[model samples]
Target chain A: MAASSTGLRYPSNKKTIYDRNINRTKTSELSRAAFAYLFVEMITYAQRRVTGIADLEKRLNTQGYPLGLRLLDLLLARTASSATTSPANLRPTRILPLLQFIHTTLWRHLFGRPADALERSAANAAEYMISDNDPLVNGYVSVPKEISQLNCAAFVAGVIEGVCEGAGFATDGVSAHWAEGAGGGEDMWPGKTIFLIRFREEVMEREEILGRAG
Target chain B: MRREWEGEKLPRVVFTLLIVSKAGGLIYNREFHAGLSKQDTNELLIIAGTFHGVHAISQKLCPVPPAQPPPSNIPTMPVRPSGIEVMESANFRLQCFQTVTGTKFLLFTEPQQPNIDGIMRRIYELYCDFAMKNPFYTVEMPIRCEKFDRGLDGFVKATR
Candidate 1:
């Protein structure tokens, strides 16, 4: 009789992570109601302040800013790992590219699509508009009658603001609004948020000089 | 690329991650993979509920330290309870990880799921990385973090 080993042997043939292929069969999914209720509580939690809509929006934005900082790093790492492209190379070293990244890559990553449009106001060069058809954060939030002007996504706008500021842009303020344009619907879809990004006038002057010098 | 293993039929497995509060409320839930059986889902929820109760009781039952002496040499360490359990049924295994703050993560997967403890650690890592760090994420509330969910999905998919 042949002697047998007491310990059970495991799979000895192990492959590297890079050699692994996508398991398309196993996908991830989450419930929407859970998020809605959570966001509702967040809005209520922020409502305890003794101030106006702007103050409330400000509080919400402050809450989201730190997240933007962390996401900037994590997003770059994830994108860099999977694809051949280096995220650090594609990273925004200047202001315009950063804003473009926010409108395109960052928006797409978070909300499953890119922002609808990005345009610098013809009347005010300092002001740039970043529009989204449906902002995920503000999807279920219904601002109370007293705080009608408040768009709860001001929290996410704040995060974007924090990200921009962290990236070295001198930002005046980041605000979210509900638009009744041709793209505006019901509780969820009608939330056409326009993140009004106002860069400091000095920053624009620097951009112009940089453009001329380059 | 290894094309030989692509056609190989491995045992089907799935995972569902949930965060339950001390009061037995569902704080966060995400199906990290889709191949889980219905029995697994029900078992996972039950496991989550049961662990939530156990953790609460454990925290309360934790004994307080006796009054300390004024001895300058000895440092008084706080007494706390560790609420962690690995539960297994016939179909799947449930790993319950709890933090000192009373937050718990319930991870359900195949009974023979390997590196499952590592997955739980990474899930906790993502919680710290995304959820706790997220300004939008309120303390002890259900996580509404898109990044946390996405990151967990990406990690599980990548490893699988």
Candidate 2:
């Protein structure tokens, strides 16, 4: 009787977040300029208290870290609960898969398009690249004479870096650079940015071990 | 008459928005669309400057007494930093909408513009949508963004 009571009182298994499903149609769409301007203001605001670019970048990273944490859950919920026939798989655990997810899924969600390219660094196993033909953050922003070296998207890079690090993937740091197009510069793509990702040595070793185990 | 106002084939034009701080400082500016007239643009800037002054005066004139203790009672909380300014002319109308936080939205429209309040609402909607939702966007500053411009242009053009 006690055993039956215990079984009935507390089920051994509980529903994980993965067990839930999301309604995909409710996702909100936003205007791009509003985001751009807002981001520009954010960077400018951060510019006030900080001593240098590194501090500003750190602030940006902090700003994005929470977002990354939120996105992880948001994407999972969206994928798991979708009524659509081709339900997307939930959160990716491994490094390659997570990178792929960011490149394709996250990029599409943010920019309405996939990243231009993603590749592992040949020289450094721990390094990766995510390229955007036009960076939304840089659009219409002509940095004045002073502080010209600053890329407002560095904050975004910090966020991406923070997210990767938070997800148990070891990251060294993330840096953003301008990627000039081959053809005459397109009118729409003034803010093209490429984010370079580097992981810690321990992470590379773990990746190798995981590769062998797989 | 209303047909031209609602015409779809107008040239691609964008209006940059700016919200100056109550202290006559440039607080917020966003170019919702591109290719607007220079005269209207200059007028909008002047309007932003003028309104900033007017908003300060209004806030000063309507001062409330201290509520809480000491520094806490320093007329904070419900502090309205500024107000709005709309510049409507024969060719176009520039709407400068401001919030209590001193943040402003400067929207440009055609001279025969109708439903301006709706247009302002849409601009505010865009501000909340893009600026607020974006983790990168800060509280206030000059807006220089291609996406915002493109989106604004698309929205206005569609409405037109």
Candidate 3:
């Protein structure tokens, strides 16, 4: 076999990202216009060769999955660095803390704010929902009437799934649905989105066992 | 009124802007406020190539510490090389900001300009929206979008 020299070269002595601290760096704000533009292109790319709206949402979900996986570690590292508590103490063990992590830490890191609301399904203990008013990714996006049922926020749902899976909480699926003006007519957020998160049966069983142990 | 407005205004701070591709090609170059001497297109191209070479060499020259044993189980991201960040002369300051994807934005500003980082970031944001997001724009290609130019113009004007 011939020797190949086509790989990328990096400077020696560079420390890996893990060795460095995450808290020292300030949160940098990105340009909304740019993000909106990139998202439009992403949707356009995903729109190609897709069977229907569900397929498009699936593509977006897949695109965001890897990001969620990477962000889980990064967000955990940030929390560990910022808080006075030890890293082990900061780890979310049960469903509540895990949901709080996604609602506050993950949401803040991604969109500069916590999710609007977090609620569990009254009928189904395994189901939870995170609500967001005016999701950043959908700021300038206007879904056509032909695909009005489609919610591009499915990408964010995928990220949520990644975080849950990374934390060892197996889930059946995470999906985004439009729930605009559900509370009342005087509601402020007309484009409110509700992300439905359903955990696997085994996960709920494990939670029950852990709950009893605690 | 126009004459009075012109008289009250100060000169522009941003002089020139250049966008270099990941492979170090000069994808976009524009002079907002011309200097005393303007370089021709060929000269600008050469300058871009030379700067790219220098940036790469500088990264190589960075000193590395002795190797240590890897940690057992923690996932770590690879640290990127920090190349030439800023260059200053009596006339102007050259600032370079590289994105995560390795595309570089080089901005030339007045020597005493404040918030160069902010300006560079805004420009980057504009590039992401106007250049990278444009369906007509192919990756690593020259940027020639009307919206990008207009956004940049507005930003530069606001800065002044």
Candidate 4:
């Protein structure tokens, strides 16, 4: 074949990805500086063909969605297999438990800490909010005055949507935005990103039925 | 090492393996046992899409509503519908395993085959390594990873 003639085969000493252990890097940590560098590169790449800030965020979000789906399965598998945890790998079926899973397990896995806050929106029955005091994705990104309304956390919001959808909790939409300041709110945490999750009507209906049944 | 390599080279399972992408496209299909009628690529894609839609509908199917607010302790855990997991007929057995990300693995085996779940899990592990982690592989696209095909073939043979 053309591949062999061109000597495209990888040498054996350099183990192919398929030969590597899935958990080889589980406990290892990556340098934040390296991550920030990559984050900046991704943002610049995402910014290339955007009509507006909203469009750029949407592009970043789509990039993160696949990551969320992959991580949902990967993390669940790791939790089930890891000796440090209980063997039972239970997917949260109800809204409360799902929120708790994201708030604690998912947040910790991704950011090395639990999310700052998880709250239900008072005005909407089907909406919930998860807040991050300082998002690493936003750490390297600084918006210009014209695009100040855009939040790079939209990528993380897409990941959340992917996880929720993968876990069978259909979301109508998930988005990230800056929290409105009560003047002091801005001073306290300038980089705070609030992820808004709006669940679909079907999910809400199922939740109601399950709540009644329980 | 030789045995592991042999696993990939051999085709010995009396089962068929199918992988449906998250977007309801058939990504991979292999029939180790070929007595069943052959399906063209278009037909397979249609089947995958139909299955995906059916699974979504099943997930959305309403649970049984309690007549009134019950007194208490109707087994605290909530009831959730997990879409079709298995189907059996006179000639063949069908088992489906849906990943958290909406990918479906459809395994067709002998009617009386055992340990389908374990085999499914092994295949899922192979997929995670050979397909999911492959940089050349695109999300929700047809998987053309050569190692994936060989790995799945090997794993299935070893299991058999």
Instruction: Pick the DockQ winner.
Output: 2
lDDT of 4 by residue, A179-201 (tens): 87636776678778899999999
Q: What is the descending TM-score order?
A: 3, 4, 2, 1
Candidate 1's clash total is 0
Candidate 2 lDDT, tens digit per residue, A1-214? 6556444335446544345345443356787766765776677677677998678777776777777666766765666666453424755667888888788766666667788889887887778988787666665455543554566677668767766876777687888766555356444555667788998888878878888998
Query: In model 4 chain A, where is the ten-residue run with the lowest total lDDT?
Result: A2-11
Estimated TM-score per prediction?
0.48, 0.51, 0.54, 0.52
What DockQ class does candidate 4 belong to? incorrect
For candidate 2, the clash count comes to 19
Q: How many collisions per candidate?
A: 0, 19, 0, 1
- Candidate No. with top TM-score: 3
TM-score of 1: 0.48
Candidate 2 residue lDDT tens string, B1-160: 8667747665434355565654565655555555564545567668677777775666576546456546755565655534335667766677767665566566676655567677778867766655455444445555544455556667776765
**iRMS of each prediction:** 10.3, 7.1, 6.7, 13.7
lDDT of 3 at A114: 95
Q: Is candidate 2 or candidate 3 better by lDDT?
A: 3
Per-model DockQ against the true two-chain complex: 0.02, 0.11, 0.06, 0.01
Among all candidates shown, the one with the greatest lDDT:
3
CA lDDT, candidate 1, residue B53 = 76
State the TM-score for model 4.
0.52
Model 1, stretches more than 4 Å misplaced? A1-30, A85-88, A180-189, B1-160
What would you estimate as the lDDT of candidate 3? 0.81
